[model samples]
Target: MHHSLSTGTPLRVQDMHKRFGQFAALDGVSLDVKGGELVCLLGPSGCGKTTLLRCIAGLERQDGGVIHIGSRDVSRLPPQARDYGILFQSYALFPNLTVEQNVAYGLTGASREEARRRVGEMLELVGLAGSEKKYPGQLSGGQQQRVAMARALAPSPSLLLLDEPMSALDARVREHLCGELRQLQKRLGITTLMVTHNQDEAMLMADRIAVMNHGKVEQYGTAQEIYSAPATPFVAEFVGQGNWLPFERGADGHARVGGLSLRLHGERAAIAHGRIFCRPEAIGVNPTVHEENLFRAQVREITFLGNRCRMSFELNELPGHALLAELAPERMPHLASPDIWVSLPPHSLQVFA
Candidate 1:
C-alpha cells in the first residue's frame, strides 16, 4: 500500500480499497501525483479508473486506506472541504445561462464584476474568450467542453479531476483537443488527474500513467517504462501488441525463443523461463545478414493503414504468442515475399518479472 511521492509530498494514495457489494472496485491501489503533474489513471471500463478518481474527489468512500493531499490526511474529508475541482463527461452547463455565467457559477460569493472578469480570463485560457456571450447550445461540442473545463477551473481548487474529458468528441477532434488540453495544463502548471480508457490518449497526455485492471493498479510508471518493461502480463499485452515468446534465462543473461538466441542487457535472464515481449515496430522486417536473431514467420494477414501496413504473422512452432509487425509502405518490397526473416533485437525484447 506504500506509494511513492516527493519528500513531504503533495498527494498520496495509500493502499486504497473500495467495493460495491461483492464487486471490488479498487484493490490495494497505491499511487502519487506530484505537484503540477498531469497524471492519467488509465484502464479499460470497469477497471476502477473512475472509481479511484471519485475516491480522490471525495465523491466515493473507500473501505480501506488513506488519501493524502500535501501530506495532510484527506481520507475522511468531504468533497467541498477537500477543495478539488472535478469535470465530468458531460459539460453540465445550464442552457439558460450564458457561457460567462456558467464559468462563473461556482464563484458565488464574488462580486458580479469580479466573477465576470474571472470568467473572461478562464474563457481566454480555454480559447473561448469571444464565445462567453453565447449559451452552451450555440457552441460546438469542442466549445462546450472548453466551457466545462473553464467552469471546473474557475474556483482554482488545489487539485483537478477530469473524467474521460475527450471521450465525447469525434476521433479527429479528440486527437486535436487532447493536445490542446495537455498544452493548457502545462501552461497553467496545474496538478491534475485524468481518467481515460484510450491508451493513445493516456500515453500522449500523461506525465506518468497508472494502468488499472480488475480494480487495482497492476502496473504504474512513466509511459516508456510501462511500455518497454511491463511488470505484469496484462500490461505487456495492453500497452501495445507484442509477440511473447517463452524462453529459459541463462546465467549469462541469454535466452532462446523460437530457436533464436538473444543476449540481454543484464546477465540474469537465464534463471528460469519468462515471457519476452517483442514490440511490433521493434521487430525488423526482412533483416539483413548482420542480424543473427531472426525468426521464420508466416504472414496470416496484412492490413493497409494509409502510410503503414499492419501484418499479422505466426511462428511455425511458438506457443502462447503471435507476432504482429508494422511496415512502412516503402519497405513492403521484401515483405511481399512469403516467410520473411524478422530480426528481433535483444534490446527490444523486454523480459518480465
Candidate 2:
C-alpha cells in the first residue's frame, strides 16, 4: 500500500464536440489535465460537464475531436479499452456480491491468489481492511463508496475518472470523503478528472477547476485565480457570491453610479455602460482615511454566521440599491449605529461589459 505506481498520465481533449439531434451537449470543449493533477469539471446542471467526462471515458462517442491519454489516442476506443478506472455517481456496487467480490470485479483474468492480494491492497488503501465479506447493503454510504473506489482502482488505471463520486452522500459525509479521496489520489499520484456541479466540492478537492457552461468550458484555472480574476460574467457569478452595480463612464473617465464617481484599479475598458462586480468580502467596513470609494451606508440587516457576519446595506449615494459585505463577528460591536462608512476598494472591483 505504501509503494508508488507512477501510473499517472497526461490527458488532453481538443475541440471535442457532441450533439444530440439539434441540441449540442458538448460544443467545442477542450481541456488539459497534467500528470498527477486533480482537475474538476464544475458547472450547473445541463452544462455538459458529465457529457465531457463521458466522452473522455469513451462512454459516449464525440461527433468530432481527439482525446489523448498520455501518448495514445483513445477517441475511437471503448470504455474498457481506455486504460482508465471510473467511479460512478451511484456507487454501482452489485447488491448480490460481497465487498471483496465487488473490489475484484475488474480483475478479470488474474489468478485467485493475485486477485485476493490486489483486493486486499485496494481495500486497505481505502481503509476497509477487514470488511471483505460484508455486502454493499450492510455498509454505510461512506463505506460503500470506498468499496466502489477500491473496485475502480483495483486495475491500477493510468487515469481515474470520477463522475460526482460523493453526490449520494449527505453534506457531512460528502465533506469527509472529499478529503479522503483527495489524499488517496495524491498518494497514488494518479491523474484524475472529476465532474461535479457542487462548487464547494470542486474548490475543496481539485488542484485546478474547469468551469463549464452551455456545453463549453468558460474558464480553467486554480481556485484563487477563478475566484479572484474571473474571465467572464458567467464565471464571476457562478463561482462565488458577488454584488453587481450598474455604472456609466463619466467625462472624467471615472465610473459613475448614481451620484458617486469611483476610480477603478485596472485600465478602463471601452464600454460606456457596464456593471461593477465586487465580492461581499471585498467591501471594507469603516476604512481608513486614505481608502477610496468611501460612502455612508445604511445598515439594512445583519446576519451573524458562526465566525463571520453578512451585512446588507444601501449606500446613501446609490439609494435603494442594497449591497452585501462580509466581516468578522468581532467587528460588529464597532458598527452599533444604523449608518456607517464602507469602502469599495478599487482593486477588488471587476468591470463587466
Query: Could you tell me the lDDT of residue 91 within candidate 2?
Result: 97
- Compose the digit string of candidate 1's lDDT tens values, residues 1-353: 12223222256899999999999999899998888788989888899999999999889999999998876799999888887778887878899999988999888689988998899889988888788789899999999999999998898776788999888899998899999998887766678899999899999999899999999898888999989888888988888877777777654677866555677656436447777777888888787666756767687778899988888887655633567899897888777666777777777877765
Number of clashes in every candidate structure? 4, 0
Q: What C-alpha lDDT do the candidate models reach, one value each?
A: 0.83, 0.92
Candidate 2 lDDT tens digits, 184-300 = 999999999999999999999999999999999999999999999999999999998999999998765579889988888657534588999999999999875658888888999
Cα lDDT of candidate 1 equals: 0.83
* Candidate 1 residue spans exceeding 4 A from truth: 1-9, 248-265, 316-322
TM-score of each: 0.90, 0.97
Scored by lDDT, model 2 comes in at 0.92
Highest lDDT scorer: 2
The top-ranked prediction according to TM-score is 2
What is the Å distance of residue 10 in model 1 from its true position?
2.5
